[model samples]
Target: MSGTLEEIAGSDHAALARWVEAAERPAIVRGIAADWPAVAAARAGDEAIAAYLSARDNGNPLTVLVGPPETGGRYFYTDDMRGVNFRSEKMPMAALVERLLALRGAADAPSLYAGSTPTPESVASFATENPLPVDTGVDPRIWVGNASRIAPHYDMAANIAVVVAGRRRFTLFPPAQIANLYVGPVERTIAGQPTSMVDPDHPDHARYPLYAEAERHKLVADLAPGDAIYMPPMWWHHVRSDGALNVLVNYWFGQRQDRFPFAALMLAMHSIRELPDSERGAWRTWFDHYVFGDGAVHAVDHLPPHAQGVLGPPSPQRDRMVIDYVVGFCRSGGSG
Candidate 1:
């Protein structure tokens, strides 16, 4: 109710780039993949889509996630959160299609989800025919399945997902809702990332009362063939594909970075969280000044660019020094 996904024309590359650079919210690029051969073929029928992909299949066995209908087409953790509900196995493209066709009309059919698989690997010419005008040389990945759903999860990289066949609904939330989403164990993550334990379709308010707060910050997008959605880095999103056959082609580009942010965060966690409450409060002030203040006193006006090193203009030696320090830290059992 509060936020909505704004739609923009797919041909507007300039607008797309602007949105990609500063998309404080999700945006929809309608008919972005309309010219894609696979998407066009899908318009004929599911068999057409299957045939096209099958013809292009390079005979490589790929990972396919399988789950029973009792899990309601969702690939997630068990009730006790010990392990994932679904299991995956390697299967060739043609065999996977045959199995999906056999179970197509069955009411009690098990779910089959082939996730974030490479488009070019499955169909060697896919990237050439369906190229997106985003960053150069960034190939697309395909997610094909039969009426399956993936739980809400955040990706570390920025994402643009194009629907090729069938329809998809994305229930999205901002990263700030991480606390309200009731996330499960990180180490036990099933779907490449730590996904929300609470099912958005049938959320148990009694068990997850905070989810209502997250919902207040939610935005939704329904994608048709050729439609695409742009999601910024670390934005939480839940995706559900409808109908018999669904295929989503997505591209992920790493966020721009020039320094060792992850290493610094790890160092901070190692040193900061164990401090006493009073000392921890002091650390917050210190972080606000040093880390969050865009390298404040240590930058620009006070120090020359050469002296500023990693905090100011880029320095190759400083970068190498930081990398070497991290490598040494790792090799020496994290000792100072």
Candidate 2:
């Protein structure tokens, strides 16, 4: 909603690595996978692409999300938010392709989506034939579906996704806009990650007025076959796939934490959120000095390095100590 996303060229491994390292926002790389066999097959036609995928099917049945035509291909929560709008069904790649082809021209076709199927197991030779340009040491996952709108959500790891078929529009928001995005329940999620309650496409401003602030910082990228988009860690993105059949392969990498940040946030909420206002203010100051502040690393400088212990620089021993302490404290009912 703010402006068009930035575009960069080149698809070599080094160039891609550099672009990812330097990017603080989403960037579109046009024709990044132009030479891929999947892209060529897609350009030929839907049937050709479907056949290309069927030829590589390894007989593994992928879990597909099926929703009625009333949902308009949007996989989301029900009106009461107590249940999901879609049901999960398992079908082989060839069978799934047939179902999609059959519903190609139907105006009220049910949504059929097979998301995040491991490329190696689901489509045996696809990864080998169409390799990702970067070397993230992570295997790619494939998403095949009809027109669908995924709610805005953030991933724990950085991502690079390439479009193999159809068209995709990515609407991205910065991590700082989390407060304005009206995030939904963390424990109850349609997917593994918590998504924004407000729909970016058709926002209900009356119910979620703060979402208007998030729109000011939005960035959008419309990608065609062979185009790719790079997203940094924890960046909220809403994805919409257009056409009767769409396919995308994405790699997620660079997650280095043993415990997720959200887990820590939950713990903090349990311990500190309901405290008295004065006590909460005191805790905020302590947190600023010891955690979020730029000068936190030097806060322990007054003490000798040998005496710093857990407050010292990061190391395997310190990490082990912290993990053990936290585990012991939790197991002992916080008595430690």
Candidate 3:
């Protein structure tokens, strides 16, 4: 087993708390299982599973599960399901299923949502369920796979992921651990499979000496079908499949979209307000040096301007705040 894995599986929440306090980063809580039945329901059918497998087999955009009708409700299988609740633009499952089957039948046929081409039904059906007590606009993504892999990347919103069919290995390190993680170019990352800076084992200790000291605060939970993991904001995690088939659903929540413009303004104004052009470029270099590296996954906001690391390291308060921020974001839905 890897040294990082050893630290993760053996450690308790108290140890995690200590790391959080010292590092001012995200923490992981293991073995919290919920809503397995619904996850299985989506993954049950051969057609659905085949469709998903075909998507991945051919390098297509995987299916996404939008929000449910109720708060924390079971995830709806189709994108159009949200149309009934909110005025969403979406491609109905019936049509989407046809698209999937069509692609399977005729490999020459173009894939759905392929390019700049507009999806009129999907665009028209974009909507969200509102008037709920909790912020519930953000649609979550659910996937079922037989030996599938997700490339490393940081999401703009906080994520709560649940495993339903099999096991998975999550290699996580705090954002501060970026220097140690050998990262790749950002342009390559946007396409998918963003990676680390340093080699996990044979790191170039001379170039990134500080990376040696980066604590790999990791946790490897052999999540049974129902278990879930909550990856807090700004945290970096890479996942690998460990079972015959791994089924997972992830919820990403953040404050309203309206606030993002404000957040971006705040970030731009505060971080680089006074730097000259040369210095500004230097700042980007600084960011590229410390936060993003060759093949590494990272958050742009977590860099200098938007916010510094978690206020006081990882504390109960900071954890709560991160959760609130994510859920809040979800409440603010988008047009599609």
Using all chains and alpha carbons, the TM-scores for the candidates as numbered come to 0.91, 0.96, 0.44
Q: Which tens-of-lDDT digit does each residue in 1-336 have in candidate 2? A: 588887877456576678788757778888889999999999999999999999898999999999999998889999998899999999999999989999999988999999988899789788889987678788899999899999999998989999999999999999999999999999889978999998888999999999999999999999999999999889999999998889999999888867558888999999999999999999999899989999998999999989988888889988888888889999999999
Worst 10 residues of 3 by lDDT: 124-133
Against the correct fold, how does model 3 do in TM-score?
Answer: 0.44
lDDT of 1 by residue, 224-255 (tens): 99999999888999998996888888888865
Residue-level error in angstroms, candidate 3, position 3: 8.4
Model 3 lDDT tens row, 183-273: 6554333233345544333447887676555534544444555455555555666666543334565566753443354354455566687
Candidate with the greatest lDDT versus the true structure: 2
Candidate 3: residue 176 lDDT (0-100) = 64
lDDT agreement of model 2 with the native: 0.90
Error of 3 at 147 (Å): 1.9
Selected candidate, larger lDDT, 2 vs 3: 2
State the displacement of the C-alpha of residue 123, model 3, in Å, after optimal TM-score superposition. Answer: 17
Q: Would you list the C-alpha lDDT of every candidate in the order shown?
A: 0.84, 0.90, 0.44
Rank ordering of all candidates by TM-score, starting from the highest? 2, 1, 3
Model 2 ranges with Cα > 4 A deviation? 12-15
Candidate 1 segments whose C-alpha is farther than 4 A from its true place: 1-3, 256-267, 294-301, 304-312, 329-335
